[model samples]
Target: MIITGEDIGKKFGKTWIFRNQNFEIQSGEITSITGKNGSGKSTLLQIIAGYLTPSQGTIYANGDQIDEQKHHSVFIGPYTEVIEEFTLKEFLNFHQQFKKPVCSIEEMANSASLPLDKMIGDFSTGMKQRTKLITAFFFENDAIFMDEPTSNLDDEGFQWWKDLLKKIDQRLVIIASNDQEEIKCCSKQLNL
Candidate 1:
């Protein structure tokens, strides 16, 4: 997949979140979107993922214009929406059931380090994050978006992210993070 944008901008009231940003993310390489607090990093990712639209300019995914209602990219989803009521296994199962090019049940469990029988309702926040990561990774889409991946992780968990960063394929990842370390792992970067 190839994502390209030019002169993209957004605003709320008088606060200009972003303006005139240009970028392109391609398959077979990992791209990181980085910036400081209030720099519109999350909003930019949401736009690229087709959840929100930029006020001006254009965004193309795979050479086609992004239509929010028809675009099918997968996101790890905001932390707020992760299912706290479901077991980790159950959650993965539910996601796989609806996702296109879904993976087998066993593959989903292993991809996210989820113990197929474990109760996700009782998992620690880090564990939950891990499960979310797995779900994002297991999805079959060419474009995958994640925001603030290290929000609740510890030092060791951060290191794990760094390690994983090197291994992520460019053909499949777009990470939006404020952490310099995480952004460094990206083969290329787009700053807003």
Candidate 2:
């Protein structure tokens, strides 16, 4: 898939978070969005993921206008929340009703080193981040948007994240982060 944007701009009331932005993201490649804090990096990613609308621009995917409800995309970020009431296995099962996972629940749990029976609410920050990454990466989606993906990761988790990044092929993966390791794995970059 190819996602293209022209003159993308976003405003909150009287203030403009970003304006007159243009870019493209294609399948089978990873694109990193980088900028300092409060620079609209997350807002841009949200707009691309169809969660937010641009103030004065157009975004299209494969020549068709993009819509959040219709597009098969997932966003992983520091604010992305997990089901606190569900165990790891249950959460995976619940997610299966919406999208097919890239692997079995057991496999995902094993890969993330998560205990299947543990509730998501009890997991540590690193574990929660790992869970989010596993869920986002293992979904069969056309687009994946991530913001500050390595916020709560440890050294081992960083390695796992890097390894997972290498496996992201044939999908439109856009990441918004300042982490050098994450940016280094991307084939292209856009600075806000």
Best TM-score among the predictions, by candidate number? 2
Question: How close is each model in CA RMSD to the real structure?
Answer: 2.6, 1.2
Candidate 1 CA-lDDT value: 0.74
List of clashing residue pairs for candidate 1: 27-171, 28-170, 28-171, 29-170, 29-171, 30-170, 87-120, 88-120
Candidate 1: tens digits of C-alpha lDDT, residues 35-118 = 888998888988888888888889987777888335445676445467778876678767867775356767756644557777
lDDT of 2 by residue, 111-157 (tens): 88889999999999999999988877887988889998989999999
TM-score of 1: 0.85
Q: Least accurate stretch of 10 residues (summed lDDT) in model 2?
A: 64-73
Task: For model 1, give the 10-residue run with minimal summed lDDT.
Answer: 68-77
Q: With candidate 1 superimposed using the best TM-score fit, by how many Å does residue 149's alpha carbon deviate from the native?
A: 1.3
Give the residue spans of candidate 2 off by over 4 A. Answer: none
